[model samples]
Target: MLNAAETRCDALIVLADVDHVIHVPLPNFTFQRSIDLQGILKSFLRKALVERTGQIERWDRGTWESFLSPLWKCVVEPVMDALAFSTPGDLSRIFWCPTGPFVFLPIHAAGLYDTKYSAPGHKVFDFVVSSYVPTLSILAPSRNIYVAHNDDFRLLAVRQPPTDGRRLSRLPGVHTELKHIKEVITNSGSACATFLEPSVGTVEEVLGLMNEADWVHFACHGIQDAKNPIDSGLCLANERRLKISDIIGLSRSRGGLAFLSACQTATGDEGLSDEAIHIAAGMLFAGYAGVIGTMWSISDTLAPIVARDMYEHLFRNGTRPDYREAAWALHEAIGRVRESGEVSFNEWVPFIHVGL
Candidate 1:
């Protein structure tokens, strides 16, 4: 299967009661397994990992920190050890295509939780920057040509107010996020337009602007419908949901980047986890070359901070704001948050870049 593949492949096949390493004759080759990985994954998922509402619930720092330590020892350490021994060099970027419950775990942030086992260059992040794709075959096609940074490049910023049914709390951070992003783009001489709440942040209105905008940033709440993934969507103004099925129908010929700053935008149904048929992947299929999404719920207060840092890195003087650089920029932005010590797993780890 690896030989016949035309695209870059990284297969992570999970099996029961097996602890071994295997190597395939391919460009990037190495695979390792743990004897209790399947059991451990099942146990981890049952604990506050996923919610009854089809969302992945946030665990308190104490709970998650304790959980991460064992998870790192059992699952991540062995895999990293094998990769380090087999591939000797500076590990730069890796696209993790995880399967089953591994999809829900934060493999990028795997490391020793306590200071006792801590050492330099121990965490996964220290080795290589990580991105994710549902499958290798889906990434075969050339990415959508991005509009160069110039006067003609456009950005659409959508901010939805609290709705009656959902009654989401006011996201003050979202206001700050939009302001900073707009200032950055306008200062760079790129065109930017906003759809504010209680007026124009509707499914139909945003869809109309999607084709013209070079980039789209949505600050709102997301819903994951486990029973019907297509019905899952971002909650817009007036209680309207912009379903995944709706996004897939868009005629977005001029592909661009989409920043889904909402809850559960990247969470997939447990039954269909391997398919990667979630909101993030849906955006890719809808024509965007790159997508920024959250695997679970994130702190509203820290959302803008991450966004500000990300745009700062992305719009730095000499850097080009292209989809290819999205993952690197996001990784650095999360690093900034981690350095600050204000927020950790709940905020920093949830922000991930999918697609190119």
Candidate 2:
């Protein structure tokens, strides 16, 4: 559990059915709504997902536009006001531990969509860098380990081939991504091993190498099984699927990091969203100290760019390569992409860092 004394935030936003409680060192006043806030949140999430998945025909852009006002009024605005009024200084980082349907909402991307108030300094991302955890207890063990600056680390990169009968689009960028990562790590005099298509990229092969790796990067397709969370897995070569159960069963000690550059790797089952039973959390449960993942689908072209920038920032800090600051590195990478104006929401917002 988080120590109230050691908490770095101004306040913690805890959502409930009819109202949300803002915890600013103590349980503060609740924001009440006449409507069923939970139902509204779920509806908003469903609409967002539909638009994200290109199924927006069911609801027009106007309808989607209409939903945002209630979302901001009922869910976001109250929390923002509470933090601004109660907090001592400027807000920098926010750790949103959402529950139930609220978990599916993109709290980091919350903003007024109108162009009048949609400037760079007017949004949530401008206020703070957001980090999420299923529960605060998972943070306890990671605090014990010292993140030493060691360049003698080993990396395992896996890139799956386009499987037949699978809906996954082929990621040609995986080749560029792996190549860039290899060049970066090896140029730093670190060990880098890869399992590329057709032969080496399999569930069995990747699992075999995971224990010895200081970091593991999976550049493939991720499937989220809403019915059975454990069965949700990464699609690899020859139609092989590496499930969450396979990852949790590893006997390795608690250490290292995982970069799941796949779709929905951080998205848990809607039915069990509070449990954080997704592939990203599964990696943590499998003993990884840090994880970088996507909340929804990401662009194939932009994935390599983001990955390249992130690794460059992470592994090439002056002379000493440090992977300990994964979250900061990712935040910078996303900022760079956003500033470039090449890609927007689906490409940038989906990428998130969990764990340490």
Candidate 3:
């Protein structure tokens, strides 16, 4: 294995499946059986650690084969044999491997991989936490790591029907909401201009403005071709599909943030990293400063509310909020809705922040 000193990158990014951690738990078994289960868990952890950390010097054959081997034999293997059969995609995808002290993984793995794993959402965080901490701590003790997690990562069906159901105008003050978010963005005084697409807008129109604007906001439906996920894209005026490739080709802009108010615009299908082209991610990989996206289907009322709060956090109050902060602001805004008793908690809490 390569040592951290020999590695070239400054930080590591982990793609975690939050659903897995929230839904799966270690099997309930006799003390001896649980101990045996631990061993198998360790094996998978070791492999993921090696691949993700890219550290070659941490490898210790005898340490792994002898001391650690039995640890899993006694604790993790049994849990795997009993529960693996019933685990859902969300639970199965939970990864607890720790890369560095500075590594930033999705929430599920981040909290789980830490020593002080007893935090909010601790139960779901346990599977990952119990799985990775011991091994990685021994391998890399001097790196910095961070985790991003939220309850909204889970799949939730939209509860309310779209008001207009067909036309953008029927969306209950869609223009006003767009204007508010755009103004909040402009108030940041970042020289970024915002545009609201009514329907299927063209790539040429986007490219023309994106070339000069420091920020771009797309408050429209972004469809992911479930069959061919990368072919998925945002819908513009006229029912045109703006494929993932089209979004990736934009030129660079300084401190640019593309707020994709589109659904599941930040996901990738399993088995291929190249196919994991999220509109927000593609923009980031193509050199945008950051991107904010949703994880699954969202409530129409909630999305605009979240966007309004995010833009307010970013452009209003002179706060220079980053992508994460902006996303949180949106969450906070929705929390207020639940607090005020205007709508239930299920109404306006459907957004997540995705970025580098």
Candidate 4:
């Protein structure tokens, strides 16, 4: 949306290459060059998300490579060529705007990983830092908010670990994550932060605190109601949920960033694919300049590590941290996650940045 002088990154609105994506996990899925797109896409989601996802956690390297190679060949390679990127370069950034069913896919992590003797990776991560934008219009108002401001860069970190009787798993890493955050913020001498852990991270309490802070981080359970996207939200204390409707209500001028370290925060409804209905987009519409969201569920073990590194990178300036740096911070943090031996594709690929 920026004029030529203000443009800093390449924007690629992705139209899903069905041949590569739809056929990756569904080898036996019948296809024609010209097929009913709606029916096929819904079927693909049912199989991959519902059927095969049961085994996604245990996917071997062979399976990971098979899917990635096709994804690179069909989707990412063309974009890279058009941008004149033959190999990895420094300081390159791309803002991906994936259209249709592609929103659920991870475009940032696409590369030819396996298939034959391909060992040294040629992944998209090497060439550029990647971020996402729901739409171009969402960017115009965020320019000023993303920059440094006169007021203190206040931060709110919320952690709602799974308690007894809840179906969710416990997040043991969030404790260490809060410790890391405190250490980072204390050393930065700029960010004024508050923590609401355990029994306090309720819907009303979080919204109340969000009013006082410009930037916010959530290390909690995120529920994605595919049938009703409006109900999709972060799981908070006492079984209270902070739905998308609740978030967009806090629209303000001073907002900077919202780091949603929760599952399916950016995964939109397949039926209404073009609409900006997810938590990340809700945060943007709520007036935050940027947001860090996940396309699918994330491992509790890795989320805190990513969050800690992201904040460290953002606040490296030691004064008021620039919200514009959130994308690069997330990019660098996920790079570490990828290199953190024994990580599968699903584990590292879900963490994504949306907005400036």
Candidate 2 lDDT tens digits, 1-356: 11112223124565323265555432221223212443554464455532122222233434434444454444455556665633322446556665555556566655565556655544556566667777776556444374554655677788857545346556667888788887777676545555555565667777888887778899888888889999998877776899999999887767677999887898878678668799988998888877898877777777888888888877774344444577777878898887786665546767887776
Model 3 ranges with Cα > 4 A deviation: 1-173, 183-192, 196-200, 270-275, 319-324, 338-349
User: Model 1, residue 150: displacement in angstroms?
Assistant: 6.6
Model 2: lDDT to the true structure: 0.66
RMSD per prediction, one decimal?
6.9, 6.5, 15.9, 7.6
Clashes of each: 0, 0, 41, 0
TM-score order, best first, reads 4, 1, 2, 3
* TM-score (C-alpha, index-matched) for candidate 4: 0.82
The global C-alpha lDDT for each of the candidates, from Candidate 1 onward, is 0.68, 0.66, 0.42, 0.70
User: In candidate 2, which residue pairs clash?
Assistant: none
Residues 172-262, model 1: lDDT tens digits: 5677778888777767653555555555566888788887777889887788898999899887777789999999998977467899988
RMSD from true fold, candidate 2: 6.5
Tell me the lDDT of candidate 4. 0.70
Model 2 is weakest, by summed lDDT over 10 consecutive residues, at: 1-10
Checking candidate 1 for backbone clashes, the offending pairs are none
Q: Per-prediction TM-score, please?
A: 0.79, 0.77, 0.51, 0.82
* Over 4 Å off, model 4: 1-56, 115-121, 141-147
